[model samples]
Target: MGRQRKIQRMAAYRRRRAARVFRGLKRRLGWALLGIFLIFQILAQLFYPSYLTLPLARYNREPYGLKHRDDMVMMEQSKFVSTRLELTGSYGKEQVDLIKLGGRLDESANFNNLSYYPKKWRWVPFSILFWRPDVLTLPITFDDKPLLNYTLNYSKKHSKKATDASISIRDGNISIKDGKKGLSVDANKLRLAIKNKYIDTSGIVRLDVPEASIEPSASSADLLHVRQQAEDIISKHIVVSVAGRQEEFIPSKEQLASWLRVVEESGKVKLDVDSQVFGDFIDAMDKLVAKPAGQTIVSVVDDREVLRQEGVTGERVNRLDFEQKMSSILFRPGVYKYISIDLEPIMPEVKTSYSFSHTQAGLQAKLREIGRRYDTRISLQQLNGEGWGASYRGTESIPSASTYKLYIALRLFDEIKSGRLNWQSSVLGTTVDGCFHQMIVVSTNQCAEEWIRQFGRTALNSFLYERGISQATTFTAEGAIRTSSDDLLRTIIGINDGSLAGGYERDKLLDMMGRQIWRQGIPSGTQGWTANKVGFLWDYVHDTGIVHHPKGVYAISIMTKGANYGIIAKITRELEAQMYP
Candidate 1:
C-alpha cells in the first residue's frame, strides 16, 4: 500500500511537468510568429510598400504562395536557350532520320538569374491558362559545358499529323543577349537541309536549333569540329538499302542534301556533298524522265507499199516515216509491238556466211530429228529445178498425206487450160464425214474418196503421167496416195513456168492453190516469199511449193512420215531462217 501511494505521487508530479513544457512551447511559437510579421513589415517599408521593387534575386527558390504578377513585369534581360534536336520523314513505306545541333551566342552577363523552383533544379509549376502535363525540364550542354535559362521545345510529325511539345531547363534563369529567338524542331522528318544560315519558318523539316547555342571559340570550335569528323566517318561506314526498290546498299543524295540545305540556308552558308551522292541524284532525275520497257511496232508492207494496215494509225502515206514494219503474216499471232525489231527480227545477227547446199543438208537433218525433239516428223527438199533431188528415205515418198490436194487443184487447172472447164463454174460440193470440208477447207479422207470416184481413177492416173510426174504416182486405195519430193518439185516448176496450163484455167488454178489456207506447215519470212501447198496427216507431213526470192522463183518439196505438225513447222521455219539469215 505504501509503494502504490508513492507511485501515484510520482505519476502526478510527471503530469504537472508535461503541462508546464506545453506552456513554454506555446510562448515560443507566439514570439516566432511576431518576428516573421515584423520582418515582412520591415521589407515592405524598405521597398516603399511596393512588391515589384524587390530584387528578382530575392525571390529565387521561393514559391509565389498563390500571388500573381502584374502585366507590366519588366524584362531586365533575356536568357539564352540551347538544344540538340532530331527529326524524321517518311516516303512510301520508308522512313528517314536526321539530327542537328544548336549554335552558340554570347549573352548579357549582368541580368538577374533567379526563379521560384518547386524543387532543387526541377521544373517549376508555372501554367498560364490550362495544364500541359507533357512539359519536362532538361539540362542543355554546348561544347561539353552546361548553359543556363535555355529551354528546349520539340514538334513531332508522323503521317502528316503534327503534335505539340515543350521542354524545361534545369538551371533556373541566366542573362542573355536581346532579340534572340528560340528554335522549334519537328522531330519526325527523315531528310534535312540546313544550308540557310537563318531559320526557315515555312519549310518542311523536323528539327531546328537556334544559332545562339553554338559558340565559335577555341574549346567550343574544337567540340563542333570533332562532331563533324564523327559524322563524316559514320556516313562513310554506314550502308542503307530499301527492299524491292534496290538490291545494293546505297544512300540517297537528295535526302542528305535536304538536311544540309536546311541548316546552311538558315545560316546563309554553304555545305559540301559527296560526288557519288550527287551522281545518284542526277541518275534519279534522268530515270524520272525516261520511258518504260514494253513492245513497239511499225506497219505491214507488201510490194514496197503499205498493203494491209494493222496496229497502226494515221495515213497510209506515213509508211516511209517509220524505220521498220511488222505483220501478223507470221503464224505467231499477237500485237507484235516493240521498240527494237532486233528482238523479233526474222534474221538474227550472224558472224559468218553459210552455203546454200550446207543450209539444205541442215534442213533435211532437222526434219529427220523432228520427232525426237518435238514429237513430230518433218521433211524438206532442195530440187535442182533441172529435175534432180537429194532425198532421205523416209522423207521422200511419205504418201501424199494431204499433199494430193495440190494434185487435184492442178488437174482442175489443166482442164480449164484445155478449154474443157470454166474458172467460176460452181461444182456441186459433195457431203460426207470430213470429206466436203476437208476437200474445201482441210481436204480430209471423205472428200478425197468421193472426188476420185467422180473424176474416174483412170483419168487422174493419165493426168499425172502427162505432168512429167513418175508413173509410180497413183491414187490407189480410198486414202492411199504417194509422191516423192522429186516428182512434186517438178510439178511446182511446171506450174510456175506456165507448162501446167494456159489462159484463164491457169490463173484460176493458181488462185485456188494459193488460197488453200494450209498455214500450219509453212512459217513466214523464209529465204524467199513462197506460194505453196502444205499437207498433213496424223503422223505424215509434206510441203510442196515455189519460192520467189530476190534472185528468182524455184521449186521445193518437203515430205516427212511419223512427224508431228509442230515439228514440221519448226524445222521449216528454222530452215527458212538458216537459209535467209
Candidate 2:
C-alpha cells in the first residue's frame, strides 16, 4: 500500500516537469516567430512589389479637442476613415491622377505640358493597425482655380450658376438666404471615371465629362439653427474671471455682437470671431488681465549659480485656448455660464538659479560667435541692477548719434524735476517739453545741442558718471560723442523702474520713447511692446530699447559700425532666441 502511494506521487512530479518543459518550448517558439516577423518587415521596407494593395489609411492627429463634444471626435474619425479614396481614376479609358486632373483644370498647365509625378512607395505591412493609427495627418493640397474657370465658362454658355445658402446678422438682427440647386459639373463622378479607366489598362482612352445638380453646404434646417445660435449670442453676457481677481471683465452685449459674425464651414453653420477686432480688443485687455512675469538676479561663479534673489511667477491668456473656451460656451445653445479658464503661467526669462544649461560662459560664447559672423562689435546688457546683462564687450563705448538725445532728454527732465528748469524753459526758441518731443520723436539735433550747451559738457558728463550710467562718457561732441550699451540699458531701466525720473517725468520719457519715429532696428525685431532710441550717422548705427513683454521686461542695446538696420534687426532676433528660448 505504501509503494502504491509513492508511485502516484512520482507520477504527479513527472507530469509537472513535462508541463514546465512544454511551456518553455512554447515561449521560445513565440520569440523566434517574432524575430522572423521583424526581419521580414525590415526587408519588405527595402524591397517590396509594386502594384500591391494594403489595408491602410491616414488620419488627422488633432481631430480630438477640448471644445468638441464627447462623440464628435469619434464621429469625425468615422466620417474621415469612411471616405472612399482613389489615387488614380479613369474616365472611360484614360487614367486621371491628381496631376492630370489639376492640369485639366489649369488653363496655363495643359495636359500635354504637365510632367507625370510618380508615386512614393511605402511597403509597411499592416501599418495602420500596429502603428500610427490616430496621428498620421496626410498632407493634401487642392487648387480649384481651373474647376472654377470651367464652371464659370459652362454657366455662361450652357448651365445656371448655383447660389450657396448664407446667414447674416445686422444690428443684432438675423437674416437667412435660401439656396437654389442648379446643373453643375459632377467632379466626383468625373474623378471616378478617370480612376476606372486608369485601372483597366486595356481600352481606348476617351475623356468623359459628367454633370450633376449642385447642393449648398448649409441646409434650410441648418440655417434656422444658425439663426437661433446668432440670437442666443447677442442676448448672452460673459464674465471673464482673471486669476480670481476682484474685477470680473464684462464687455457690453453690443460690443460683443459687433465683434462677432455668423458663417458656414464644413457643411455646418458656425460662429467665428472677427480676428482683427479680437486682436484690437485683446491688445487693450492684455495689461488689464494678464499679469507680467517677474525676474531675479543670480550670481554665477565657476560654472554654477552660487547666490540667487527672490522670484515671482506670472501668467497670460492663451489666445488659441481662450478662443476655444469662448466657442465652447458661446456656440452651444442655452450655455449662459461664465467660462472657467486657467490662464497659462509665464515663467521669468531669467531663471531662479542659473545651471549648466545657461551659464554665463555659454551666453558670452554665443554673443562672441554672432558678433564674429556680423563682423561688428556687439554689446547687449540686461538692466537688472548689480549684475551686468551680457558680459562680452558690454562697456565698449562707440559713437552715439541720436541715442544720446535720450540722455539729453533725461538731464533736461532731471532739471525740471529739481525746479532748476521747467517744462516751459526755453531751448532753441522752443519750450523744454516741445523740444523734448522733437529731440526724441524725430531725431532733431537742435534741442539736444542747445540743451547740452546750456548745461555744459563737463556737468553733463559728471551727471552721467555720478549716476553710474557710464564710467567715462562724452555726450557733448567734445571728442567723439561716445556711450556704451551698458549706459543705454541703465538709463532706460532707471526711467522705467523709477530710479532716475520721478512719476510724471518717467511717464513722459517712456511715452516719447515708444513713440520714437525710427523703430526699424530693435523695435522691428522683438515681438513685444518696444520703446527704443535709434542713432544713425555716416558709419555708426545703433538702437537701444526696452522691450516689454508679459514674460519679463528686456533692455537691449545694439551698436554697430558699417551695419544697417537689417543687421541690427537680425541681432535682436538672435538675442531674444537666446534669452527666452
Candidate 3:
C-alpha cells in the first residue's frame, strides 16, 4: 500500500508541470501575430492606401467616406457656331454658308461631348482632396466632299479667262485690244478652314477663301501706241521719179499699207516697214532709167585713121541713195511734196582704138627694143586668128612659178563640171571657190599646193596635153611648172572662146583673175578691162592675159628671166601703146 501511494503522488506532479508549459507558449504566439498585422497596415498606408477603401479595410475602421461637390464648370463657353466663306475679284461677289461647323453644348457629361473631371481620386494620399475642372474635347463629324464640290463649282462659274494684248491690221487700219486681270479661288484652302473650325469647337467662325491674280501678257496702252504709229505711216503719200525717164512711179496707199508690219523684237513691240518690198520697188525703177554706155569711134583724118570722138558718160539711178531718201520721206508728214533723183555719170577708161593690123610691125619693133635692155631670154606672143600671129622666141619653155595655180584652178573646175566636185565643196580649211580665189587673186602658195595635192600633177599634165597646150608641163623644176608664151596664149584664147570651160566657169575664173590683188604687171599698163595672171619667183617673172581694148580683144603672154617687175611693166606699156596707137 505504501509503494502505490508514492507512484500516485509522482503522476499528479507531472500533470501540473505540463499544463504550466502550455500556457507560456500560447502567450508568446499571440504577441507575434499582433506584430505581423501592424507591419501589413503600415505598408498598405505608405504604398496603396486607396485600396484600403475595400470591404476588409472598411470593416476594420469606420466606413470610408468620399467628399462630393458639384463644382466642375464647362471649359468651352460658346459651342454652337457658323462658318462663312467669301470670294473676291473676278471670281464674282459670292458668300458660301457652312452649317454646324462647331460642336453642340451638352448640359450633362456624355461620351461624345467635352467634359471636365476632378484632379484627384477619393482616397489617394498626398493628393488634392476636392474635385477640379479639366477640359475634354469631342470633335464634330461631317462629309467634306460636298463642301469641296461646291467650292470648285463656284470658282469655275465666276472665273474670267485671261486674254493677251494684241495688235492687228484690217482694211488699211490698225486695231488693238487691251488685256484684263482675272481671279481664281483655291478649293483646298477652304476645305482646311472648315475642318479647323469644327475641330476647335470655337464660338464664331469666319473664313475668306484664298485667291490668286491672273495677269495678261501685254497691256492696253502699249498696243494703242503701236496702232497709232502704223496708221500715220500708211496715210502719207509720196512721189518718186528717176532722172531722164518718161515713166513716173507713185506708190499707192494700199501698197504703203502692205509695207507696214507689226513685230516683237528684244522683248518690245514695234511697227516696222518691210525692207524687201521697198528694195524690189527701187530695183524696178532703176532698170527703167538706165542708159547704155557709149563707145569711142575711129575716123579718117588727112588720109590717116585716128581716134576722133571721146566716149560720152552714161546715166544710171543711184538706188542706195534713193532708198535712204525715201526712208526719211515716208516718216515725215509734210516735209516734201515729191522727190527727184539725178543719175550719176560713169566714165570710160579707154576713149579710142587704132587698127592693130597696120601697127603690128611697129609693135614688134617696140617689143624687140624694150626686150634688148634685159640680159635674160624673153619669150612673147600675140594671139591672132585661131593661132599666134606674132612671136619672138615664144617656143622656149621656162619656169612658170605660181602660174601653175591657174592650171590647178582649171582642173578643180573640171571636177566640178564632171559632178565629182562642187564650187562650195570644202577642201582643206576652205571652200573650193575660196581656194580658187586665194590661188589666183591673192597668189597663196599654201592653197595652190593643197589644190595640186588633191588634183594629181600627172592628171594636170594630161589635161594640158589633151587641150593641145603641149609646151607646158606639170611641176618639174625647182618646184615650178614649165610653160611657153605660145602655150599660155593658146590657153587664154581657149578660155575666151568658151572651149576650155562653159561660160559660167570661164567667167568665174576670169573674174577672179581680174580682181587680182597684185596688179603691178600687165594690168598696171592697160587702160581697159584686163583679166590676167602673173607669176614670179626669185629672178623669173611672167604675165599673161586677155586685154579688152577698143580696137578688139586679144591675148598676150610675156615671160622673162633675170628681170624685175618694173622692167616687165615698162615693156608691157610700150607694147600696148604700139598695138593701140
Candidate 4:
C-alpha cells in the first residue's frame, strides 16, 4: 500500500508537469501563428496588395466575365499617380518613365513597382494596404486598339517621302530640284507610348511620337543660285551699231530671252547664248554695214591720171571681230557702254578712163595741108550734118568707076523690095542673092554687069533721080557712070540710116560694104565698123563711105585727082582722128 501511494504521487506530479508544459506550448504556438499572420499581412500590403481585393458584385455577375481583373485594376489604380505625362521616342518606341510622367516609385514595394497613389494619399501610412479604395482615382485610361490605330494614322498622315536632286533646262532657262527630307513614324516611340499608357498612369492619354527627319542630298541654296543665274542672263541686253551711222540694232528683251540659254558644266549651271543665232545676227549686220570699193576714172587715154584717185577707198564691217566683241560683252556680267568697229580700206586692182578732143576744123586743115603737099585736087565732105559741110570742089563730077556698082546694088535691092526680083530666084543658073553678094563683097565686074543687065540702066538712073542725085547716070556714055561726093555721101547716109529701101536691104548692103575686098582707103584709119567702095582709074583714086565712131556715124567722101593712094589714106586717117579722138 505504501508503494502504491508513492507511485500515485509521482504520477500526479508528472501529470501536473505535463499539463503546465502543454499550457506553455499552446500559448507559444498561438503567439507564433499571430506573428506569422502579421508578417503575411505586411507582405500582402506591400508586394501583393492586389491579393486583398474582393471582386465587385457587378463584376461577378454572369456574362460580365471580366478578364485580367488584376491587371486592369492595377492600370486603373495607377492613373491617380499623376495628372500630366512627358513622352519620348527612340528607335521607333515611345518611352515615359514614372518620374517624367509626374509619378513616383513605390518604395514600400522595393521600387520594383510604380506607385499609383494620389498626391494627397502619398503621405498616408500603409495606403497600399487597401485595394480599390475610394480615395484612389484613375486619372487616365488607355485603349490599346485606339492608341495603336491613332499612332498608325498619325504616322501615315505626317510621313514624308524623300525627293531626289535634279537639274534640267527648259526654254533657255535652268531649273533645279534639291533633294528633300523624309519623315517617318518612330516605332520605338509608339511602343514606349503604349508601355507608358499602362505603367505611367498619367492623366493625359495623348501620345506624341517623334518623327525621324531625313536630309536631302542637295540644298535649297544651290537650286536658288542656278535660278538667279538664269534670271541675270535674261535681264541683260546687247546693242549693235555702226561706227558713224545713226542706225542701230538693239535686240529686244523678248528676243534676248529667246536667245538666252543655260547649260550644265562640271555640275554647275552656266549662262550662255546660242552660237548659231548670234552668228546669224552678225552676218545680217555685215550685209547692212559693208561697202564695196569702187573704180576711179579720169580720162580715156591717161592711166596715170586715173591713178590719182587711188586714195579713194571703201570699207566694210569686220564680221569675225564683231562676233568676238559681242561674245566678250554678252557672256560676261556688266553694262557695255560702247563697241566700235572701224571700216577697213581697200585698194583697186586696175585703173582705166575714157576722154578725147578733136575738132572738125583740125580735120579740114589736115586735108588742105595734105592737098598742098601732094598737089592733088581733093574734094571732101562730112555728111553727119553736125560739123563742117561739103568742101573743096565737092560738086566736080567724076567717073564712078567700080563705085557705080553701089548704084546698081541699090537698084537691085529696090527691085527685090518691089517684088520684081526674088533674092533666091535663079538668074542665069545663079541665085540673084548670090550674084548680089559676089557683086558687093568681091566687087566682081561680071556679077555687077549681070545685075545691071538684068535690072536695066533706066531703072538705076530713075532710082538715083528719086534720091536727089541728078548727076548719077548708070551704063550711059559707053558703059561709064559719073557721080559727085555729095551724091555718094547722100547714098551712104541713106544706107547707114536704113532709109535707102528697107532695114533688111540696107543692113544687107551695109554688111556687104563692111566685108568689101578693097578696104585700103576708109578702113585703114577707122577703129570701128566701116563700109566703103574705092574707084581707081590709073591716076584717079576715090574713096567714100560711112565711118562709125564713138560720137556718131559719119559719111565721108573724097575724090582725088592725081593723088597718091597713101595721101588719100592719110586724109582718111586725119578725118577719123578728128571724129573719134
Please report the candidate that would top TM-score against the real structure. Answer: 2
lDDT of 3 at 516: 79
For candidate 3, the per-residue lDDT at 395 reads 71
Candidate 1 residues lying further than 4 Å off, grouped into runs, are 1-389, 394-396, 424-426, 429-449, 477-479, 524-528, 549-552
What root-mean-square deviation over C-alphas does model 3 reach? 42.2
How do the residues 440-493 of candidate 3 rate in per-residue lDDT, one tens digit apiece?
A: 876656567776777777777888788887744555444357887777877777
The predicted structure with the larger TM-score, 1 or 3, is 3
lDDT string for model 2 (1-581, tens) is 99999999999999999999999999999999988887787566444322121223122333222221112222322232223224221222222233222221111111111111122323454332333223222122233443344334533443445545544555556666576676655555554454444321122234545656667655556666656666677677788776666656676665566556445677556657766666665666677778887886676543456887756888877777767777677666663568654567888667533333344565566676667677655665554432335644567777776788877877887788779998887765457877777677666565677888888888998888888887645765543578877687778777778888778878888898898767778888887789888886434678887887444577777777767788988987877676656
lDDT of 4 by residue, 1-581 (tens): 99999999999999999999999999999999988877775554445332223222122122211223233333333343234434433334333322222232221121112323343542444454442322122323343433454456656765776543544455555555456677777654764555555432335544556678866544546456556655565466556778887668876545555444444468774556666666676667667776667776444321123234553566777666776776577667875435776555665444544332344554555555555556544444455546554345556676665677778878887778789888898764358886677566655455677777776777777768888776544456442467777677777777777777567788788888888766777777667667888765423567778777666667777777656456667877765665555
Query: Which of 1 and 2 is the better model by TM-score?
Result: 2
lDDT of each: 0.41, 0.60, 0.60, 0.58
Candidate 3 CA-lDDT value: 0.60
Give the alpha carbon lDDT tens digit for every residue of 1-581 in model 1. 99999999999999999989989999998999887776665544333322122232322233222221211121110111112233332221211111113222211111112222223222211221121112011221232111111122223222222211111112332111112223333322211233222322112223333222222222222233333432342233223222223323333322432222111344432223334433454356335332233323332221122232233221111111112221111112332222211111122222222223334454454443433455433333343332222334433444575677667767655555567655444343222322323353433333455567777777898888876877546776443577767677667767766777556545544554555555555534344566677765433557767666553344556676555445555665665554444
The most accurate candidate by lDDT is 2
Q: Which residue ranges in model 3 land beyond 4 Å of their true spot?
A: 1-359, 375-388
Reference-based lDDT, residue 573, model 2: 82
Candidate 2 pairs with clashing backbones: 89-194, 89-195, 90-193, 90-194, 90-195, 90-196, 90-197, 91-193, 91-194, 382-389
Q: How high is the lDDT of residue 325 in model 3?
A: 78
